[model samples]
Target chain A: MTDELDRDLLLEFAKAEQPLKSKEFTTNVMRETQILGNRKKRSLWLYGLVLLALCILFAGPLVKLGTMFAIGFISPLVSFENPWLATLTMPVNNIASIVVAMLIGGRFIWKKASQ
Target chain B: MNNYQETSEAGIINLARTGDPRAFEELVHRRQSIIRNLMRRLCNDVTLAEDLAQQVFLKVWQSIAQLSRVNAFDGWLKRIAINTWLQYLRKNDAMRNSLEFNDTVYVPPPGSNGSVAMDLDKALLVLPEQVRTCVVLAYHEGMSHPEISEAIELPLGTVKSHINRGAKKVTEMLAAYKQPTAGEKV
Candidate 1:
């Protein structure tokens, strides 16, 4: 009986242990965790945006070169059908247009990179 | 208690990992009371206990994702709490100085009823930090000897020895208070 009583008393004392009451404890912890979570999300989005920008920056030259090759290959067919037209306008106009588009794209990329 | 079970500590941990701040807060609310009590017993200073409690929760928040195997949540939190307390003891020069000075001659004032509860708190304070941690984790936190050993990173034999020695010392202290000294007249 004595042993049982001692055991009971010990258990009761253990059960009574409690944490302190901080008025803003929960609020403070939640706010901090939320901020951390948001920061993680923002960093992931930033990474995605950087990858997209790189794709646009490098794909521009490749696409322009491909377009120039396609025009050159089709030039013979067009000249065979209309000799006067081919003689009047050299393919330099196509190359110039490509160069101008590239210049504009490059200016935009440089502006973004500076920012 | 399906809702309670569904919101069980494991559930709360999962939710907290998925960015549910409310779930993390719920976990804190559920465990804070016991944690505060443990801190109070360990530090024997309410203000310090409160501070340590906050630090414990902050750590729990920061490391929630690293907690795998949800069943061990309580044990994991207890380990964090113990480590946080130990770190605080190590870093705070003033507390370290006080602890060293007080260790030899610390005694509770007379006249209060020698309640088992009060005696237990005082007894816990008199123990060395590692022994006190083992005792508190074993008795107060309902952890087994193995659990206490794991939480405090001590050997199993050391944990057992601390519990035995701590309980014996507390028992002796309480017995001394119960028996009157010869010089005093009732």
Candidate 2:
């Protein structure tokens, strides 16, 4: 009863026709998608290049700096007669470097957050 | 994709995803009338419905690849069309709010048959947005309860409740209109 009435009304509503879009709409959508796709590709390439440059600039230098600092500072303590002390202090030096790096990273993030 | 090649509708979607403008055009041609009708019923405005229908197709073109199941294209497209209109309505909330606030009276235009159709439309307009959407999708679009729930992202129980409430309201309005007023002579 109610279902039949609802169904009839729905059919009547569905039978109503809407105006068609202009022919240009299809071409316009394709063009817009193409433009967006191109922009995405270019931006991805740019990000890849920037990442490569950052790795080149930072990776080798950071590793070298870490190695040099570890050897320069820890080698002296390790060269001493007390090898156990040197071993213990070697871990301390590594921990200290890691702590310093984390502090600097944290401060940078904090600054950005505050802004 | 070729699995659905025998089905022209699925084939059209596959081609459209692969950037075949003609295939996409065919898909649009086939479904435009239905989409337009759905839009008109959902929005209650013919011109806006047409514009939204075009926007729906444009979105379909742009996001075709993201659609994996070709068979469910109609449901997917309908969801897009519904969301597009919902977004438009949300953007124009101020206008709707003002209209509602100023127009408290629900005066029926002359020559209304006091029939089920006019009563239902009037009753639907007064429903909450979510409920109205469910009713429209269920009744107007011929979607099953599950389909309506999925399209509108509502729970099945909620969808059923909406339909029930919407139907009750329409029935009540119709019944009220049928009864004679105190001042009116038989």
Candidate 3:
């Protein structure tokens, strides 16, 4: 006779498994839930906090710069009859937009990467 | 979660369902091993098993309010464990069709050979994710085929076939560990 068993022996083995003992398993899970369970709310508050700070820090300067920019470009175009409106249309505003976009994108990427 | 009071498991689960942190922590302590072991069998990686176990518990904590009966905790926990594993597989695209998936041969853990139980675990590792899941629920968890279908959200017939096919494959895989009849020789 060939080597064989009369029963599906895998059952006994399956039941015989001893769970791997983990130290502080409950503690670790509890810690993760506390830290991460509210991640969506936390991330929302984080972005809001960052945006609020950016607004607080740069609002005055940005407003001042914007007004100066508008006056400089529009007034010049109006008075000088400048044909280079296309050229003047973008540069500074685009830089400011790019800066804001980078701040938001950088924060997002940093948060995701860290997680 | 600080207050320590010993109570019946159902009481703790009820308190946990009501968002009582201490009760929740107690529940976690009681059930963590079962979930952890189930995850370990599912993934076959210690770290990922622990991570998935954590996710399972986290989901339990977040949705314990939705659990209708405290007595149903075991089934609820097993369902969560399976879903957590399934999500991980789907997220990683780790469980593609067998022919298209890069099959990772099971490397038997040290001191795990010879014994049928150990060999069975190695055999389980050889199965595709969905099939292995059905097999594990049936054999390891002692769940009925219909129960497995409900747990894993597969059709009844599909679950039955997966268990059948998986059981046969595992038996074949373990044939090497079979004991010899009286006159049989190496």
Docking class of 3: incorrect
Better of 1 and 3 by DockQ: 1
Q: How high is the DockQ of candidate 1? A: 0.18
Expressed as tens digits, the lDDT of each residue in A1-115 for candidate 3 is: 1212224644554564765554589889878877775896889999999999999999999999999875654432222245476456545345455566799999999999999
**Alpha-carbon interface RMSD of model 3?**
7.2
Model 2 per-residue lDDT tens digits across residues A1-115: 2233364445544443334564554455456556766888999999999999999989998999989876665443224457687666665455456666799999999999999
Q: Against the true structure, candidate 2 has what lDDT?
A: 0.66
Rank candidates, lDDT, best first.
3, 1, 2
Q: RMSD for each model, in Å, please?
A: 12.9, 9.1, 12.9
Candidates' chain B TM-scores in the order shown: 0.71, 0.65, 0.76
In angstroms, give how far residue A12 of model 1 lies from its true place. Answer: 6.4
Q: Report the C-alpha lDDT of model 1 over B1-186, residue by residue, as the tens digit.
A: 235335766677888766466677778777887778888877777788878888898888888788877888887888888888878866763222422222444465444576655666775667766666656666666678876677656688877887777666656555554555565565
Chain A TM-score by candidate, in order: 0.36, 0.45, 0.36
Give the residue spans of candidate 3 off by over 4 A.
Answer: A1-10, A37-115, B1-5, B99-118, B150-155, B178-186
Query: What is the Cα-based lDDT of residue B128 in candidate 1?
Result: 66
What value does DockQ give for candidate 2?
0.17
How do the residues B1-186 of candidate 3 rate in per-residue lDDT, one tens digit apiece?
A: 344456888888889988887788888887887888777777767789888999899999999999999889988888788888988988987656562111357543433336444566677778888888777777777777777778767898988777777777767666644545456574
Worst 10 residues of 3 chain A by lDDT: A1-10
